[model samples]
Target: MANSANALPETGFLRLPQIVGNPHANPPIPAIVPVCRSAWWLGVREGRYPKPVKLGPRTTAWRIEDIRALIASL
Candidate 1:
């Protein structure tokens, strides 16, 4: 899954878990944008982060461009 994130070709959406990232203890530690689900929702409500798009009744995601912009701003 981490590889898939790094492998994204150009543009797409990313689910919350993917955005937060996975942790590994081995060599070449992956970059993790760690944020708890509640804190993320709070950021959304406070406009500190991009609003997510509802892909279905129980699915939500944010645009890759928006996530990149947020990372750049930080």
Candidate 2:
């Protein structure tokens, strides 16, 4: 009998390794870097991506999964 490991589906998004290399992930940062600001905003306006989360006093970030889905759909 032969054993094989099934390929896992992309479950979460992550930050591009260029900036951070495999740090502990909660919401999967993103394998690729973030998209442009205007583009992201447009995506939100189009209801393609979910609203961003408040990270700091004023900073915000979109759900990585949402971003990935948006790109895929586009």
Candidate 3:
């Protein structure tokens, strides 16, 4: 069976893992794009990736719509 971890939802936000993935987990969370967290952040800083929204004091996430547009551009 294919790993469903890479699958994205139609809407809502995505966390770092749900974007870059956590493949080492027991279920092996898949990645929509294979990238290191540091590089991802760098891309974000460089405007190559989507901007994150501050959900809380320590929470940050990206919108699925933004992510979809990014994937389309890629």
> All candidates' lDDT scores?
0.73, 0.45, 0.84
Please give the RMSD of candidate 3 to the true structure. Answer: 3.3
Where model 2 places Cα greater than 4 Å from the true spot, the runs are 1-36
Ranking by TM-score: 3, 1, 2
Candidate 3 segments whose C-alpha is farther than 4 A from its true place: 1-6
| lDDT for each residue of candidate 1 in 1-74, tens digit (9 for 90 to 100) | 44444555458888886676546534433443567768888999999999999999999999887777777667
- Return whichever of 1 and 2 wins on lDDT: 1
Q: Order of all candidates by lDDT, from best down to worst?
A: 3, 1, 2
* Clashing residue pairs in candidate 2 (N, C-alpha, C atoms within 3 angstroms): 14-29, 14-30, 14-31, 15-29, 15-30
How well does model 1 score by local distance difference test? 0.73
User: What's the lDDT of the predicted structure labeled candidate 2?
Assistant: 0.45
List candidate 1 segments past 4 Å from native: 1-8, 22-31
Supply candidate 3's per-residue lDDT for 38: 97
Clash count, candidate 1: 0
lDDT of 3 by residue, 1-74 (tens): 12332366778998999888898988987788789999999999999999999999999999988888888777
